[model samples]
Target chain A: MSDNPQNKVKIEARDVQVFYGEAQALHGIDLDLNANEVTALIGPSGCGKSTFLRCINRMNDVIDGCRVAGTITIDGQDVYSPEIDVVELRARVGMVFQKPNPFPKSIYDNVAYGPRIHGLAQSREQLDHIVESSLKRAGLWAEVRDRLSASGTSLSGGQQQRLCIARAIAVSPDVVLMDEPCSALDPIATAVIEELMEELRKDYTIVIVTHSMQQAARISQRTAYFHLGNVVEHGATQQIFTNPKNQQTEAYISGKIG
Target chain B: MTEPSNPSARKAQLAKRYRAERRFRAYGIAAISTAGLILFFLMGSILLSSLPAFTQHYVTLDIDITERHVDTQDLANSDWRALARNALRAQFPEVSGRKEKRALGKLLSIGSSDDVRDYVTANPSSLGTSIRLPLTLSDDIDLLLKGVIDRDLPENERVVSNQDLAWLDRLLDEDRISRQFATRIFTNGDSREPELAGLRGALVGSLWTLLVTLLASFPLGVMAAIYLEEIAPKNRLTQIIEVNINNLAAVPSIVFGLLGLAVFINFFGMPRSAPLVGGLVLALMTLPRIIIPTRAAFAAIPPSIREAAMGVGASRLQVIMHHVLPLAMPGILTGTIIGLAQAAGETAPLLMIGMMAFIVDLPTDVTAKATVLPAQIYMWANNPERAFMARTSAGIVVLLSLLLMVNATAIYFRKRFEKRW
Candidate 1:
């Protein structure tokens, strides 16, 4: 550990509440994501973990009747501010969905989509280099490099997910949010992605939502447990797994309550 | 595992079940064959009855184009009529030998020289050219040639006299009588006489009307569907719009014609029988059909694709233009083609707007008086001549071919744009 206070917090959420029409989905919740570390949010279905992840990038804005309230800031800039452009904000905070959603395009175009949209790479050569390096970093280049023109959907399920990851990283975002990125994959593909995430954390702050506690322990440096729309506890992965915490957190980690 | 039983009883039960199965299969086969038989009968009847209309018989004459016969320069002493009579006598010596030369001249329609006079006067450049004009054969002669008028019938009962029949047979034996495919049916204008009728005017009118309908309906339908499916809030107003669109699709086509009459022709004072007014009416009828299917296609797209596009920094408009619209293209095209086919087949609404009138010249513009294919067929079917029956069948064939072409185009585009994902 660097033990440096300068790398203290990258993202801060204070008393965030979300609603779908008249029903409340998330209660007021406070959390902080540290810089250059992987934080995993673990919870059961309908526990609002994915909802919280979506709010960070304003993905919930597309849903009809969905309203999010509270303050979320990235690097001291208010993400929920009226002046913030959602498109620019999303370009900064990229996301990978739960299911593998490789666009109905060639593998090369899938990764190039983000960079092309954000104007991150100026020329074709720069875009090609970005796609190659991003795919390499996602550990998908070896399997997919020869067939870049083939449809992204023609790949195996695991490769499609990695392609999505590569697409998210190609824009060179500050934070990468993954919503159960490995839930759709087998154990072999899951291990490959976990290794890729370990390498990715060196430059980008990563937040992952997963149902597997073992995965949370293996990949993430910090862990936050959510229950009934509230963050029950959060600490270092080792401390949260092995040491004292709230009873709900203990019960959830021990598999007594999801 | 099998339960032990008396062999004969088991055999009887099996036989009963087999009998029921055989009965069901027989019923299915009978139903299918019945449908096939009905379709074949309908198609065969149409093709068989309409074949004779394709040919028309004409009498060819070698009339010399003498300058004195066509020129009427002397105002007080004009004698082109005497000159035409002399020219007819010179061409057909049999007319001069007949005691009733006047009746023979009427039967041959020698007055058709008036048509030639008008043509030559209008186009003086063709004064020296010998044009083989195909004059309209009289309906009685056409029936006699086609054997629709029986010689066995008494003189008063039969439309053609025995003398006329004998003369027609001699003309046929001399090889002067010839039948050619009726090109005039496609080139000339509508007429009360089936022998002179053609679809040229009606076809032109339909083309103009369809052009207007396509221009006014397609974009408007697509825009309405997009707003309803993609952008509009799900409120009572949206629900009402949805219901109205569906209801409009089921509204009788003639109701739209009434609406058009009351609105466009009466209130707005647009020219009656003009293609513009007819097109507006048909467009109103077709809009709901196109919009409903387009909306359904837009709705079938997965919400995830839209979310992914938006998440990747695409604007709402960009998401729709780049993804949703392309995905929904096949359905939209199908809907449009079906709407066009329905519009092409519609007749009752056009009837209300005066599209059934006998327009003798091709429509010069959208504002010109016009008829359509179905209206033309309807008018021909009601004509007194038996020859029009064949003409009506030919018109049906043309209409069917047009519909087939439209459907084939729709299928081709649907296949081209179909996406597995």
Candidate 2:
């Protein structure tokens, strides 16, 4: 709605409906995520924001009896098309979970897992370089540089989450999806991740589903408020938080209803 | 309901809870001790009864294998029993009747002929000279020496006659009759005489059978479990298959034996009483056992680990091979080894496959006619001879030890490789 020519749509979703078995979870969602910017989706618990985030990389396909019906495109390619290889699609679109889920392996191997599986490096030195740069980008290189041989789970909570981020970006995906990456961290750790997100938006398109509105307003350029599986408000983050057009969005933002 | 804001009421409630906890602990201790007592009695009786089988009586004789009696050119055809009988007659010069001489010959085991032949064949130079050698005693005399057959029993009630007893007493006084460890129980194969019966044949048979069962069931069970747990969709067909697998585990083991007899022996023309057929039967019996636990092991793995791998662009097969398998390996191995242990102790199914036959020669390969440990124990237990009772108990001890070893290996693998997420 801003009519800015410089904002390019990196992923576009139209009328996306999701169903788990016989129970419908999301109904007809429409949203656009722009290139080199962060889009924040804020909703109450069980409001389908995480489900929508999982749709971009086809993560929902792995769940038994879970179906997503709609056209979701990344750079004009339909992700649900018959010819689309889900492995390649996921390689181009990475995801991080709510908890810090690093493989029970050495820290270097955890970050190199993606690159190795995707064949992104030609030699061990190239893989080492990829792991180093990814960790550096996630701001975890300084804390874990000397302990790459240690298990990823042996790290502190915030550091482990950053290691997961480094792992997600090691294959150099164009889009990164984060589902409440800071929910399990303390305020200081959350702040570190929020700062990392602001820096990550310079190179990768990011979509985050957060429960905290303040987290959305602090790091995201675009904001969408979801209620009962519907997008109630969508616009520039400043405009959506300050001057929302919808009464439900205002009620949620003002703590009147969730 | 007893808790209250008042301090005295809260204190009473806490005391009651503590008392209940202590009572529960007492019950647990009592249950464990009862189990321990039962195990102690069971093992004590088996060990006590088996002790007599460990030692055997041998009658040593100074016999001359003369050149005339033993044709050195025809060692295999030489009448070694006649030479032993002649030496025994030489011992009792005053007793000269044919029946008395036959009774005197009965003191030594029939197998002593084979032993003399074997010695003479090995040491040809000692044929003409007199050599002292230990000869195996007959089972009845062996039992008498071991106090299994009561020496005080009346003449008709006991298998050992007065004349035989007199000869045994004289030999004992002369230090010619001796009791030593029964090395033959470990070295020889099955025989009608209890003194000559050993577990070597049955032990080898069990080894071959378990090898076949492991090779047949483990991979098949694991592959089936992986398919059912990870890949197969939850539908009517898979649900039916799951129910059938559970039912298969509950089917009487004898039914699997019958199936093996019919399908493998009758239809496929596999050898009857072969370890190969017995192993195939046991494999069928243990398959559902392995699959159930393998599936449970797979189910215990957190789905998050799988999703994490998938998020990094791993294919479904790669996710299982790289992450899920390593995490579940300890559980899988424990389940498989426990299944094998159960199969090792199984007897009814092997009986249906004719493994209860009286096998004498050690099975050289899987397809040879053979019997397992439990089958051998069963055969010995069914024999009416008093000497067989101790052998039966000894066979049970050996079987129990092997089972213990297998179960211990299962526990060792579980503790050595178990991983925490």
Candidate 3:
């Protein structure tokens, strides 16, 4: 694991501005996400945290009036370049949404969806191995191994969330973006996911958008505090929690305001 | 009651609430019963009126063809009708007047001559012999046998003249007349004579028209819906297209008939009364019907599903084909059944397309002259003959039963693969 503060940059955003029709949502923003590190984007609602996460994999393209201006590069290729196919970019940078949205299929098929679409596995045995390893990595294999044929929707909320994680990682993506991945789960389930994120960053560059300050402080290596479409402060997680340079970050930590 | 301070007020409130509930329940039951009774009366009336069309009576007569009547040198050019009439006249020698003989000949169906010719052709060696053959009785005679002519009415009041009535009674007493299941009504096509008509032509025409409609409309409608709902950018042009499609659904169906006439028949030079052309017209009408529901089906899917598929690197087309389309298929099929059923019963469009032509031949292909079931019913309803009225009711029975079957199949599909998730 790259525990050093100076890890190679995996994704770099420069003068990033987003607009929905005529209304600008993000004013020129710059951020660099490091490799094999968990970078948590913590902000209040409608503060452009989720929008920034979406820009990495070009998911904002699906929105009707959404437009992103600036250079956002992954592996030194601008994601918004004319030659960049959004499909392949998304294949490289997978996402886990806030709510667990599993395909209406069996548990085994749910995990196999990514590998099957990407054609990453060559044979049935290879696919089975990938599914097993992905589920094991998501900390769900032992509990669901016997019920692989059961519907993914039939699982409990925590299990379904982990299954989404397993589905995202099944394609062997280099980066994973999670938007409040544990927002819909109980505290116990949140702790379990937080622990899984610690293990996930051993291979994947992870960016998480979270409302929970404690979750960000506990799981992420670096934390950025956002307020009103701007990054108010960013540093090591412990430094941001103990020694805040921004008044909004201090007020948010003290529960004076969101 | 013991614990409450306002016990009387609470009791009165409960009683009023119960009364209101009872009144609501009574209203529901009354409405259901009223609808049920109306349906029962309609079915009973159709059944009572159509019973005769399901059965037919025929006479077993012996006819002789001699060398003078049929030339051996030209067996192909034969007059079986003249021979049948002579043999029948010779059987009843008491009929001396020419008028009485003509009435006796009227007792036989106009198609009876074809029956005789067919019999002669099938058995060539027995051409000169007196062969006993069963020939279709005239519509009046058949109605008389069914007891619809009302024998108790004075002879002048009834359709059958007294002279032929006595002959019919005599034939009945001699056991020369007998009833059989109405195989002819199901086997033959539309006829001026009800006894010679059948549902085969209408059934085949309906099937062919619907096959073409389904083949043409389903994919087109589904693709249009996918493009509009899934892929198209929301702009003024797309908005206009949406409005036009919805407006097309509300436009009176007969307008489509005129459009089809102008575009398909006049401009394209397609044949009238051919199921191929009729189907093309019906397909154009059915496209909006299908697209509306297909779009609704796709709309019902939560956006999360599409995002999930796209998140896995599935292209937009792949996401729709693999995930969205599969989930929406049952609803799409339900809509298709409704569209096809409507096309099955559509008469006005076909009427405008000239599918109302009196077609007696069963179509072997889509281009052959054909009349759909509703058009057949419309033609039968317009006939002056009482026999055709009964056949019209029978045709209604067939059409309703087909609609019921389509609805049942739709329900089966709904129950089979409805994705609960």
Best by lDDT: 2
Candidate 2's residue-wise lDDT over B107-213, tens digit each?
A: 98887887789888889889799988888889999989888899999999999999899998988988898888998888888999988899999999999999999
Clashing pairs in model 3, backbone N/Cα/C closer than 3 A: B185-B198
Candidate 2 local Cα displacement, residue B6, angstroms: 7.4
Model 3: how far is A188 from its true place, Å?
A: 4.1
Docking class of 1: medium
TM-score of each: 0.88, 0.94, 0.92
The TM-score-based order of candidates, best leading, equals 2, 3, 1
The lowest-lDDT stretch of 10 consecutive residues in candidate 2 chain A is A1-10
lDDT scores in order: 0.83, 0.91, 0.89
DockQ, every prediction: 0.54, 0.69, 0.71
Ordered from best to worst lDDT, the candidate numbers read: 2, 3, 1
User: How much does candidate 1 score in TM-score?
Assistant: 0.88
As a whole number from 0 to 100, the lDDT of residue A248 in candidate 2 is 88
lDDT of 1 by residue, A70-129 (tens): 999999999999999998898889888888887777899888887887788989999999
Better of 1 and 2 by lDDT: 2
Query: Candidate 3 on B1-421: residue-level lDDT in tens?
Result: 5444697977888898899999999999999999999999999999889889999888888888676777666665667677778766866889988888898888888777777887777778886688887777899889988988887889878888887878878888889898888887788888888878889999999999999899999999999998999999999999999999999888887888899899988999998888988998899889999999999999999898998988889998889988999999998999988988988889888888888879888999989999999999988999988899899999999999999999999889878878866
| Candidate 2 residue-wise lDDT, A42-153, digit = tens | 9788889999999999999978899999899999999999999999998899999998889888999999999998888999999999999999999999999999999998
User: Where does candidate 2 clash, by residue pair?
Assistant: none
Best by DockQ: 3
Q: For every candidate, what is the interface RMSD in angstroms?
A: 1.4, 0.9, 0.8
Give chain B TM-scores in order.
Answer: 0.86, 0.94, 0.92
